[model samples]
Target chain A: MPRHELLTGNEAVAHAVAMAKADVIGIYPITPQTTIIEEICNLAANKTFSPKIVHVESEHSAMATIIGAAFTGVRTFTATSSQGLALMHELLHWAAGGRLPIVLANVNRAMAPGWSIWTDQNDSLSQRDTGWMQFYCESAQEVLDTIFLAYRVSEQVLIPSMVVLDAFVLSHTSEPVEIPDNETINKFLPNFTPSFKLDIDNPCSFGALLRPQFYQEVRHKLNDAMSEALIKINESDKLWKQLTGREWGIVTEYRADDADYLFVTSATTASTAKPVIDKLRKEGLKIGLIKIRVFRPFPFEQVKKYLTKCKRAIIFDRNISYGHHGIFAQEIKSALYGVKNSPEILCYTGGLGGKDITPQLIEETIIKGTKTKLNGSLFEWI
Target chain B: MPIKSYEVRFHGRGGQGVVIVSKIIGYAAFLNKSYIQCFPEFGVERRGAPVKAFLRISNQQIFIRSSIEKPDCIVVLDPMLLSQHDTLAGASSDCLLIINSRTADLQIQKSFNNICVVNASDIAVQNGLGTATTPIVNTAIAGAFAQATEIIQMKHLEKAILKYSPAKIQENVKAAYQAYNTVSKPIPLK
Candidate 1:
């Protein structure tokens, strides 16, 4: 039987890593993400988990350690936030390019200059082109369940995955979680038996420099693998649901099918929009919410399908693309390009550096979006 | 009718177990098969800084992952906080204020329609839960909250205290029970 217990998002991630039977975990402590490392270490000390916990000096070394461990055909894990994630930028590409299937939990936090420890999408969204699969979770249960699904999909496509949740908002908030037993997890995820590994017996050089003759081809193949991962990801989600009776779609639609207006967002912001949307609907407003769960291997078809019937879309983005509009707004516009009679999209960007996205604010956004002249401008700030 | 959702805010100093008390309430709600979320306002870490925590309980799965701006109930673990912060800023007239003071302040008494008071510091000291100077009043306050609100069962609250209390579980549990027994009726505003 699955055990029901209260756990923070970070603690849930640690539990998932342990249940996944990861052979190694790389750690460098940072606020909002420190509890994950602490819980993992505690689980190890209690003898309930037996992974080799590698305490590295920096996030770069943490990613490096995991990459090295994954090369040995072992399941590996690591976690970081904000600056720590920024420091691991180079190795993030290395892990994905090497096709290591290592899983990382990035507590999404705002980048620093003035200093902050709050929930924002800037950290993970900044790594958009890193080639790793990204899953933005709204709750602690999703944080736990997504890790298993990430590993399942990554191993099949030989791509790395990042499971993301909001800093402090989800990381520090305790929620009731149903922990899947080890036997059930073992059945769902087998040991990592990669066809390629850093074995002395075989003695093959991994990540060797490719000549100009073959570099582009290798890049094309990686892109093809990502396309293949889209299929594999859905398949993995279905399989997980069959086993655990829970599934978070690549793009989740909430009462969006026949709505005239839609609120599209990701992570905790998406969650915050739910009650607001419900209240608006009660007022007889044809408004709904679309939560973008999987950012990388972007669910283009699902997004397009949801937006087809809506008259307008109010996109709330926590991270702005600086010079450009909100990244999701940019992506959605790109997705809907050339489609006949697509909804006008109004992108409102704010909530950076852990500012609250309250229900009142959401309701106000809806009211403002309704009042705006159609196609006047696509970008605004809350 | 049962509450579809209830948002709660806890006001106290950093070292007085404000966060833990919210978690205990969350756990109690969870034990009843209700969805709950508990978190603290992110702040600079210190021993005596004014801090706040929040708890949300709902029969439905909670999807709003944001701070409670308009709380249905406010739990003040420190009476001193009432003078310093707008602890009742967003609370409605009918919103319940459960405080740890021996007596409600004159302004506070005039401010709310419903207020519940308990000498949680005295209860904690009597039970040896914390030092006399800085008594850990969270558990006692939580107990008073349970008594005043009648939202959480005393049995479930006891179980949560046992599971989440950092140290001296027996003392904490005793303090909670004593406060539950001695908490004042919901006094109307003067």
Candidate 2:
């Protein structure tokens, strides 16, 4: 039986990482995300776990160190937040291009212009093109479950993965978590016996300079692998449900059957939107909610499958893309383009830098979605 | 329908172990086999500045992640923060206010009929739990909260404090016990 414990999302991730028996963890402390690595360090010191804790000075070095460990066929882990993640931009491409299967926990914080360390998706959303498989978690249990799911998918596909959660909302928040014991986790995730590695017995060039012809082919193979990863996520999710008693796939649907208008959200906002939807429904409104669980490999099929019936869809993006629009809303619009009688996508970008997206604001946004729900690139400051 | 979840908020300065108060309550609830969730007021917390933390304890699972708009009980670790911030706003008329002070403010006692006052800082100081100038009142406040609202027991609070404390375990336990004994019973609303 899975034991129930009160754990912060950070602590949950740490517990999962420890259960996975990662070989190396090179972490640099930053707000919100700092506690994840700190908890891991404490667990390593107090428990029987013995992952090599690489004390790195900067996030760049942390990413770089993980790259070295992963290259040598070790399951590696690392964590960071906004500016810390931003500092590792160049190395992010390296891990992806090399297909390291490294897992990172990104506590999503607002990017620094006015210098705020609050909840927002801008940090991770900005790296959507970085080729790492991304999974957005709604709660502490989800954070714990998704780490193994991410590792399972990433290892099979041989690509890096990121598990993103809101800054203070999930990262700092404590919740009831169903902690699966190590023996159960071990059965699900075996040791990282790499198929290919850096060894004297098998010498081969790694990350060498290549021409466009070979590079294009490698990129195509990576693209094909992403489609396979979607299949892997579905399979692993089922197996996880069998092992534990809970599972969330690429996306989860709630009350969309009789809804005229639907609200789309991710991370903690999706959790908040649920109560609002229930309240509005009690008041005799036909509204529903769809939470995006997996963002990378985009999950367009799941999004379209759940949302095709609605008259309008409201995509809530906590981070702005500056001149372009909301990051998530832009993706939702693109996903719905070229479809016949598609639901309108109302783009609302609020809660940046940890601004509260109250249940009242969500109810109001549903009303606003009814008005602007008629499509196009709308950059609502809300 | 009966109450599904109980919302509790804590108001204190940054360095007063305000955030830990939520963890202690949640841990106790978890030990008692009830579902509990907690979080602090999202901010770049600085010492001596006002900070707030929230906790939700329920018999069933709690799924809401939003800020508690109307808290069922409010614990004021730094009683001065009651006026510095609207800690009492949006609370029910009969909502409980647990203050860490030598005596309950008459106005607050009148405004909130269900109120309890415990000299948490003095208890902490007497037990040498904090510096002479800055008395860390988190454990003491937890004890006061236990008596005023019965959310967590004093024994559980003391155990949690000691479990997390690297040094001065007895002192913290003493501070909490003192507050638990000294805190006035909550005065029910008329």
Candidate 3:
């Protein structure tokens, strides 16, 4: 039986990781993201969780250690934020190219040049082409549930996955999460064993220098796996939903049917935009919200199919693409290209450095999207 | 049925545990059948620097993830913070103001809203909960909020504070009672 536990998003992820029985857990403490590793450390110290908890000197070492462990073909987990994730840039690609199904929970924070510990998407969005599967969660429950889902999909496809959520918005905020029993999780996700491993009996060279021809084939294989993982994502979501009676698909609809205006958002902003959508709808406007939960595989086809109903669309992004438009807005435009009757897309960026994205701001964004003159500017920062 | 949502903001300095105060209030509200969210606001966390923590409670889950700009109530944990006089800048028109000072009545000018006061620092010190120099008034104010605004019950605040306090649970509980007993009736300024 499931029980409702009031937990922060960090605690929920830690709980999920514990239930998943990750073979290795490596972490370094970073603000907002620290409490998560702290919870995991406490669990390990108390013997509730048995994974080797490594308190590495730095975030880079944390990722490096996980890479070596994941290459052995065991379930592995790590958590980081902002500069910590940035420090793992080299290994992020390595984990993907090495075909290691490593699951990372990245609490997204604004990158430092100005040195801020606030929530933002730039940290993860900046790594858009890292070839890792990405899932942006909106609530604590979703944050917890995505861990199992990310691991399942990653392990099945042999691709790394990043479960991203806003720093304080979801990370520190507490909410009631239905925690599924360990037996149920074990049944859903059995102990992970890699299809191929670094075993002495079946010794094989890994991550060696490759010519362009061989490298292209390796890259192609990664793409094929990522494409296949989309189906696995849907499969995992369905399986979890069937077992736990809770489900979050790649794209969650918010009263979007029979509506022509849509708010395309991810993470906490999607939830904030929802009530505004409802309020507008109550006032006889047909505005709707479409939460893109899974960002890695892009869900381009689904985005196109669902977006066909929109007369206008607003892509609310927390990340600013310097000298250009909001990152998600840019991605949506790319996704909607050549599709007939695609909505008129507008991008609005705010909530940088942990600024609040109130329902009022969301409503204003909707109104702006509906009435903008569209003088060819990429986006306007609110 | 519609869910009513209320926002509470805390103004204080660092090291006073205002952040945890917000969390305790949130936990209490959650246990009381209200969906709760709380977070701290500051550019850099330094001791003696002004810091703010916010809380929101609704019968349904709150979707807005932002700082409480227009709070229904504002609780000031440090009486010294009143000297700058920018405490209740964005409070709602019909706000409830709770302060942690014996002389708060003299400080607040006449306003249409209600003003309630309790010497929370004295309560904390009287109950031997905080040090003499850095008196901790957060837990006391959590109790004061319950008494002054009736947004939360006494039992719920006690349940949350004692459960979450690192040490001196008994002392904190006593301080809570001290504030609960001492908070003045809301001065309704006509």
TM-score of chain B of 3: 0.91
**Candidate 3: misplaced stretches above 4 Å?**
A375-378, B1-4, B109-112
Q: CA lDDT, every prediction? A: 0.89, 0.85, 0.85
Candidate 1 chain A: 10-residue stretch with minimal lDDT? A370-379
| TM-scores of the candidates, chain A only | 0.98, 0.97, 0.98
Better of 1 and 3 by TM-score: 1
DockQ for candidate 3: 0.55
Using Cα atoms, each model's DockQ against the true complex is 0.65, 0.60, 0.55
lDDT of 2 by residue, A351-376 (tens): 88888888788888888877663435
Model 2 chain A scores worst on lDDT over the 10 consecutive residues at: A370-379
Clashing pairs in 3: none
TM-score of 3: 0.95
DockQ: which candidate is best?
A: 1
